[model samples]
Target: MDRKTELKEKRKKIVAGLEETYQKLVEYKRYKKSPLIIAKNGEVLEIAPEEILPTTPYITNS
Candidate 1:
């Protein structure tokens, strides 16, 4: 095994992941309000609010 080989393998994996994400986004119409939502901060537990909530709410990062 060599350094170049390892790098090529890593790059391949990254490209595969990016492709998968792109496909998911393209086929996202079936999934409305995706259950697999990402919460990058605190107070993100409650989703699907009926009314308007303040944007830029106080949410601490993990």
Candidate 2:
């Protein structure tokens, strides 16, 4: 593969890993009944677990 192609593949893997990690984090927070804190538009917000929505669909291995 060309260097550019290799870099692209690496980036894809990184993004996928980050997405999976984020899903797990959301689940953990929900399980712990903790809030999801985020910063947007120079404002900090604490979203309740019940209000937090996963950015990706939940995947299960069966």
Candidate 3:
């Protein structure tokens, strides 16, 4: 197989297992004491004790 096809197949296989992983992360983020949870490019980031502002008021006033 070509290198591009090999990489695509590898990515597909990696993505196939992510559903369960994301489910577990959602549950953990809900229960854990963190305000932000981000997953990107194979990295997981957690921001603790952050503030969540109401965006609707800010958006409508502009």
Candidate 4:
């Protein structure tokens, strides 16, 4: 394989690994029933899944 192709393949593998790790984190958090926390302006905030707003609008047919 060419160097460019090799680099692309390596990047793909790294991305896949990151995705797998993220999934595991999600499962661990769910099992522990812990909310995601972040710090902003020297204040800590907890965010649960339900607290997140949807990006897409809901559509309904009359």
Most lDDT-accurate candidate: 2
lDDT head-to-head 1 vs 2, winner: 2
lDDT winner, 1 or 4: 4
55 Cα displacement, candidate 1 (Å) = 33
Write down the lDDT that model 3 would get. 0.56
TM-score of each: 0.46, 0.84, 0.37, 0.63
- Name the 10 consecutive residues with the lowest summed lDDT in model 4: 53-62
Please provide, for model 4 over 1-62, each residue's C-alpha lDDT reduced to its tens digit, 9 standing for 90 to 100. 99989987887777677667766766666667778687989999987844533232334341
Q: Comparing 2 and 3 by lDDT, which wins?
A: 2
Going through the candidates in the order shown, the clash numbers are: 0, 0, 0, 0
lDDT (Cα) of model 2: 0.86
Q: What lDDT tens digits, residue by residue, belong to model 3 across residues 1-62?
A: 99989987887666656655655555565576556666878999765633422221212221
Per-residue lDDT of model 1, residues 1-62, tens digit only: 89989987887777677667655653452345433334556544534433223222233232
Model 4 TM-score relative to the real fold: 0.63
Task: Write one digit per residue (lDDT tens) for candidate 2, span 1-62.
Answer: 99989987897787789888988999999999999999999999999998888876535342
Deviation in angstroms for 24 in model 2? 0.5
**Candidate 3 residue pairs in backbone clash:** none
